[model samples]
Target: MSAPTIVAADLPAPADPLAQVAIARAAFASGRTRPVAWRLRQLEGITRLVEEREAEIAAALSADLGRSAVEAWLADIASTKGEAEYARKRLRWWMRPRPQPLPLNQLPATAWIKYEPLGTVLIIGPWNYPVYLTLGPLVAAVAAGNAAVIKPSEITPATSALLARLIPEYLDPEAVTVVEGDGAVTQQLLAQGFDHVLFTGGTEIGRKILEGAAPTLTPVTLELGGKSPVVITADADLDIAARRIAWVKLMNSGQTCIAPDYVLVERSVRDAFVSKVVDTIRAFRQEEGTNGLRIVNERQFDRLASYLDATSGEVATGGVVDRDRLTITPAVVVDPDPDEPLMTDEIFGPILPVLTVDSVDDAIAFVNARPKPLAAYYFTKSRAVRKSLLDEISSGGVVVNHVAMHCLVPQLPFGGVGESGTGAYHGKWGFEALSHRKSVLSKPFAPDPQFVYPPYSATALKIMRKLF
Candidate 1:
């Protein structure tokens, strides 16, 4: 199927976006964000605020996405809290300035790298895992000492409302502000010049952000979604892999940007892995409350449904969809053609497609044929196979013998190449994005010796040449 454009009526509002940008720029101009201590204190404040209002955050997420409080806490609130602390604990190290030795000719001078804050960052968030995606980057911006204006996803209104209303009260309203609205607002925000922009959402929207920010030549960090792959090898532990994968996946009814969209299993172990995954999913749903498998909203429900109807592949397990309950049964589609609708787009729902491949090379080729995914996973005990796979395939990040664990690690850089995304985040990369490295050099107090001065006599030229 051809990729289609979404109509204006279908799109949400971007009402009053520029005002937020202006507020943020004015705040940056105030120089309140220039100090490292102020940024660290702000990050700490975010952490304290989340802990104090955990219940409120959970409720907001639950109401918005029909997500359970437990799920909301685990996915959104906890993530934000962790990110805030992560930034806070490391702020000193991240902000420390190094001392450089001066040359013998200029002993009084010194030179060192300084991580200066980028002015007025604009963060455009995604609907899937809205709180984490929005706040995670915000945490990084705070850490780097940049004033940020956050644009939460309009599709998740409760979240957007909560963030916009509460963020200013807890955070430095001058340093951090939330602008709640749709694409129109985002375009308006992009129209205003920002030092940098960080966006997390679909590829189509990411493209619009890029185009909108193009005039100012403002750099952007896009945390867009793609069809991230998970390969289940024949030599893998089916039961262990199934349980862990299902646990991480069924968190938000599989409405995760980095969730394993599809699985590639060797034909020899296909049935066993399929059975394990199905049974595991069943167990997972039984534990969930009535609203566990929420379809987000009507629009997403329709979009997720389209994949099921348009796909030519036979359903391996559940194909059920109930709008009243706002749920789709944990679905597994087997033997799907790579060209089918189910395989075409990033499936950010409970549906899981299984593609059978004969060998690891075939799986690698399959993933490489499409746009570079945000992540890739392989569940195998074999070290050699893991190394070989890692060496062959390129992705934003990887999880060896597991799925989706790489993002949790604070050390590694996370972002996609080509279509998936442009830049990485987490840890130092976040600081790097928000900080500018301005090289500083000092010269000697003495009238500096000039070996190559313009007015050179023959004797002076000879001496200069000898010195050279």
Candidate 2:
């Protein structure tokens, strides 16, 4: 089936930047984003909207990237649905006022943490996993009770169009709206005075988003990508390590922000490890209905093709490019020079690089040299190695025996740190990001005697000493 067409004329059309802010502010001022019942309704609306439009969603995905329907369901739509359900079920518990204690000296007063919405929120989503990226933050915003304007990636036109058409039909424009355009529209939205802006994309764009938001002193949460590393220690299970890393690295055609960029295998088991990776990539071929990898669009296809360099590495397996399908066969590159273009940027495709090293310590050092990644993975039976990796390295998160599974746990905070980007979200963290944790303190109306007041005579000091 051919992809659906979204003519420039077909959309709600881009509104003036000022108008977007004006509408969002008005809705926010109305206090629509703060009610728990209202938030649950929005969540329910999103779920029904996505389910009712499943066919269009699948077709648009297939047309845009040739992704199989099953893959779309598993990789994209399911997560959004799950997040919506999770938030709706738990919002009451999450929105409950938290209690705090005053010291014995101040027992007469009471204090508790209050959560309040942070007016208008701006959400900028990435092309890879467009559906999940778009809706994930929206769920958080709705739960936190904030008006949001979501800008989907222009690179994936079909998904972007489907979202723009369907979202407003199910949601109130004043509370939740979809805005579309190129980088220009993105810049325009970022220029506004949003209470909070949550962006999920590449680090390069993450930086630009920061630059735009900085002037307003607006708080921003950046979910950026980096060279997420995986380490295989001497004592690790070779086959299990290979299969786990291979599967995650190829999921979404390696477009995941935290997919393993390269492997640092212990020299003693290096040969066996490479064999296992090769075996695992081959296993997917025999498995029925495997959406092994997908090439999202032409620009990315061209970008992946242009990255190969003869002097950089040795291709150990399939490296052919199927231009018609925009599919590149999974390939393993070994001993790639540290300075190769592959190492320089986030490789958002099905290419895995393996570098052998003497010790886990060496691998840790190599990863530390790069900017702090969004995630780091280590495979080992030894508790010492795992502890060292956890304590010594800095990342948004760490996985002990797998890659990219940190996103599954609803309790853990998800977001990059340092250059990979800063600010965290997911579960309670997400709610907090879209809301304010306002602190308050109260005292008795009755005036109390000040033991150390300016009547600092010797007799007054003796009485104050007893109070202390």
Candidate 3:
């Protein structure tokens, strides 16, 4: 059956930036969102939205991103539903305050941390993975009982418009608002002073977001991208490594932030690994019945094409570029110059570069020399090698024998360090990131002692110091 038509008129009407923030602030102030039942209901709403509107979401994603139905479900729809369900089951435990033991001198006082919402927050989402990244942060916001504003990326208009239409239908419209626009609109919303802001996009844009939020003193969480690298050791299962790396590298046409950007293989097995990867890509394309992967826009297409033009590496297989179609055959370049554009830039495309290293030490040194990545993947059966990679690499997250799986598990915190990005959010980490842990202390007046006052004798001072 064909999908229903979604015109511009069908989308939710855009709201003024000032009024959007004001309405969310009013909703938060009304105390309607503070209760656990309300928070859980919002989570349930999100799960229902993903469930009931599955086909519509897939259609929107296909319109905006040219994604297949299964890809859309795996990357955005299922991932989001999993996050909401995970948080919904354990939110009460996450919300409960834990008692803290007081010092000997303060025995009569009880201390604990109370989790509370940080008023209203803003979620500025990226073009890639629009549904998951945008609504993923919203799960945290509502889970912590804060009102929110969702700013979907303008680059993917269909997904943006679909989110604008569906969010209010599923969520509390008064507590959660969707404001659709470009970067300028995001800047205007930032000016309105939200309690917190979570942005998922590229690094340069993350810097711009930081600058925009600085004046308002608003806390921001950045889920930015970098050249996430994958290392293949001689001891690693060559076929398994090739398939895993190829699978994730081709996901969303390799636009994923945690997708393996480049491969660092041990020189002894570099040729075998590269050959297997090339064979895997061919098999995958043949299986999918597609000649090329889709690029989001002409600008991104031109940028990716330029990298291929300037690369000092051998284009091993599939360097075909069709600008008119905005699609590029998934190309595997063997041993590109380290300083070349393909090596230096975050290749947010189907282009994958394989660089050879002498040993695992060289691989570790090579990754460490550059800015920390959002994720680092090492494929090896050697526990020593795995431990070395885990111990030495300073990345947002690491996966052994797998690529980009860390982000899928809600138990792990997902965010970059150094230049990649800042702050983490998935499950409990997300809840705490959006919530303010207020410290509470209660004391009885009957235990008040004159010796604890401002004036003190020498003996009292000594006693106080000893007690403290």
Candidate 4:
């Protein structure tokens, strides 16, 4: 079957949120997306979209967030492509239903779970990683054989417009549609009652999404943000840890939800780790030939600048901020007060705070006392320390000896707990999250036991009870 023709001009003004959902739902009802071949075709189309439009995607990202070509490729283009490729390769196994053993009571019965698509779903993307966050969830929706309506972040207008133009050309236009708008538009879409809603954004906005979907009773998967912490033990390789932390933290000017929001190091090695991190940050900036990192907008720039202003701790390096340029040099804060905003709030900028702890236990205790984060990172060589940290703290996911690498792993379920967020989706987890597992049981005609009838004798009742 040929792909449907959908373009910006074909869509209604403001995209008529209800009409978009209706179109996808109608397409889903036709059952064209149910076949494995069609699903694979859609997934491959996404891969083609990335491959053919690499330059356009990179340029859009740069225009929206000032992300360099290399950063754009790694975070938006490559990561999304990897997810599509991974899901496409394993979709067959994921679609196959596994045979399940029956209980003793049902002697001649067979049971298994079949994964079915939720008619039509909505994916609301965030601006920080516009292409990846938007397309990433779409990958899951498509892999699950469901129709999808994608709402790219309005904050990244350039990327959003690009997606609106490109998605229909690449994927099944009727089955998958892109609706571009702001928070009000998102609220309007949520009011239309989708099968499932997956939103990636801040906690406050997540709450609103949940509230908006409440009337429709739509199941929602919120990939919200929080103060994801990094614990550095004495036994960890400080050099490697510093490099990894600095590398991820500086990516996209630290706008990532899973970026190390703050670091807690053992008191003994605190000074050394801080020094290494400073050197690493400096070296990275020098190599990139950029002294200051660009913030997404003036509001975010002011917010990050305020954190620097309020902090009572010593600024180890890179505290300079250019308000007019909307950029702040990567700043490292040492021993910031626990009650201050720098430590309390999720610093979604190019600022790093390194706090000294008495021991690994202290670091774990500190993390446990706060709301659960989206992710928690630990750098330790000792197995005991690693195990202890894993068992003790609660988070969406964990990465040992590195930071933010878990998000790249397609096999792992990525999400948050408590205030961080709810639900998980990546590869099979993503497919499962968007797909419903329907339980099926088959029985032979001979297995219609008379004991199960309403009119039963004492012996029949006794036998039924025993069997049950």
Candidate 5:
């Protein structure tokens, strides 16, 4: 599908998208970015940018997504800073060649895998957590020693413009360029044949991105979203589960890709858990004055509103919607019809649906019946139950007794599965994702056998087969 055209009026589209790619490509060719020192410097620059410009980034986030300063810092600034710092500390070790064990047939040779840059790459940022998602991949790209072109989403114009302005000032200008435009601009950049492209957005957009990159055969890493289900086992801690679920659900007004899209609670504890979750939402909103969760735009606002309208489920609390402000109050719907849009579609809003299942089997069946989600969250105390869910459910990642904490740790890879996303990137995973692992083998010319090189005589063939 051709992605809908979105022109950013405030931020002018790049005059030449290919030129942006060309500049990065030229920069990559210069070999300046290849050095370990340069990689470390860029990582340091990212850390410094997030540190010194905390207020600016928060302000931009507020203007773009109505995010509070604390939420802004926690979600975008702090997370990104951590990722860059994590990479900076471990990049030299990551870049070192890893020796590969050779088979007995190749005993006289030595082989190793060398990590190298994939030249110029493209990082297409999403609007929700604009700064972090965009720059997080850049962290990986630069750490892998590749020049990159960052395409920040036009949906969040303020943050997009801010990124376009600030990125060059902090990092190497030629090696990294920010192109601000819409889907058309993204398509244009894809056509330029990047060495690799990492896109974070919806699965539909991901398909379009893949299509756009097809002609050039550009390798892509798609961080797309699906309905990540939160399974609450009967043996779980309801209070902690409620708090954790409400916390991530309210973040960025539930626009997060890995936020609990829906809940599947064992019937026995459904009421208690639902009540606690609703209460937690009330308490959280009261504390932060976030009764009305902000939606990015009218399209998203209307989409979320429709889910609330179509749901056959009973509303537990907070069903308020203000079209004027584009805000939908935090809501909990109990047992919506499985076929309903609220249950089926990815609810990228503050309105969460809580469904009750008789047993863990029912919950597993419900989740597995659908496309694999980016994340599957299970709140359980029992090791057996945790193991069951972990083994039976197929998702990109899983969190036990928590929601979305896996994303914060750079040790674990973050990405989606099936419709959710393609590849993962965090600390070392990100480094490896944007890098090429070239196999290097060395052998002495004196030991090279003629049987391995020539038209085979029967005796030579038998010898070659025995010692290939």
Candidate 6:
């Protein structure tokens, strides 16, 4: 069905950032959002928002980032719908109180943990995949029965504006709010000190969010970006490995936080793998019927173009850029200098660097020396090799024979280690992260014993030591 056009007059004017947060806090205090039925209603509202506004969301994404309709549906719409559906189906199970095993001394008591809301939560989203990142955390917040204030990235104004318009229409306007503005506005919101904050963006910005939340002692979940790496073994399927890597690298023009930043291929298969990767890129580009991939904006385009200009390695394929259109053809750099920007910094673009390593041991050592990535990918047929890599390397998550599939799996926790990110949130993990597990213990007053009281005699003390 054709989606209706979003008119600027129809969208509510950008709310006063502080006032928006205040509204959410007030809504949370009203106790209206805590019931299981209310949580389900909000979850269902999110599903309706996505279902009824698919075309609008796609149009907003295209206006903001030049994203294709199919790409928008896959990355932002379907993924978000999946998260809400999963949470809606499992929230009842997630909310059930878990019984705890009591110690011998507490025999007459029963204990269990009950999940409760964390009050108002603030979700600061990034330009890339703005809707999914913003609403994905909101799913957790609402499922945990907390009011939410969503802060969409200013860089993607079209998507942000659309969200501001749509969220209030579909969700409970009092319980969930969308605040739109630049970083300073974010700072103002942080100062208000929400119960919890989740920010998804670059590492440098993540540090600022941490600092901003520090004064308030507000906990934060930072979904920051880093140089996520991929390792290809000698026995790996080059055909499958190349196709997967190339496909993910081209996603969102490689602006994804979990996109394989660089490749460490075994020396024996380096040349063949590089060849296949180049072929795969060419084939995919032809299939998509695009000469160059669109970058979000000029700053990102300039950063990516500069990396291409400065790289010392051979460009195996695709070194073209169209400045007028703000797009860059995919480029594969082979064995660039390790100290260059292409190797040192997180290349959030359609640039792939394939580095040759002596063995899987060398690949492990190489990844270990760098900051732990948000994800690490390995393509190997050997069980022992996969097990060894799994044991030796530490990342937010790892995928064998694939790339970035972990994010789509609702059962697994998705996050980073060290610099890549701080906390995990997806499915139940997300529900738990956004919840406060309160421990409750019930005991009968009639069971109280005289020896348990303070002023005990020698006989009572002896009995307490044996039977209390």
Per-residue lDDT for 253-336 in model 5, tens only?
Answer: 999999999999999999999899999998887865755888999999999999998889999998789999999889999999
- In angstroms, the error of model 6 at 379 is 0.2
The CA lDDT of each predicted structure is 0.81, 0.82, 0.92, 0.93, 0.91, 0.91
Models, CA RMSD each: 7.3, 4.6, 3.5, 1.9, 5.3, 3.0
Error of 5 at 422 (Å): 0.5
lDDT of 1 by residue, 50-149 (tens): 7777888888878877778887777877877877777777888888776677655445577888788888899888887877888889888988888999
Q: Encode model 3's per-residue lDDT on 78-157: one tens digit a residue.
A: 99999999999999999999899989988788999999999999999999899999999999999999999999999999
How would you encode candidate 6's per-residue C-alpha lDDT over 1-468 as one tens digit per residue? 222322334535444777777777888899999999889888888888898899999999999988889999999999999999999999999999999999888888999999999999999999999999989999999999999999899999999999988888778787798888899989998999889999999999999999999999999999987999999999999999999999999999998999999999999999999999999999988865657899998999998999999999999998799999998889999999988999989999999999999989999999999999999999999999999999999999999999999999989999999999999999999999999999999998877777778798998889878875
Best by lDDT: 4
TM-score for each of the candidates: 0.91, 0.91, 0.97, 0.97, 0.95, 0.95
Query: Model 3, residue 31: what's the lDDT?
Result: 99
Please report how far candidate 2 places residue 463 from its true position, in Å.
6.9
What's the residue-level lDDT of 377 in candidate 4? 97
lDDT of model number 5: 0.91
Q: Least lDDT summed over 10 consecutive residues: which range in candidate 5? A: 1-10
Span of 10 residues, lowest total lDDT, candidate 4:
1-10
Candidate order by decreasing lDDT = 4, 3, 6, 5, 2, 1
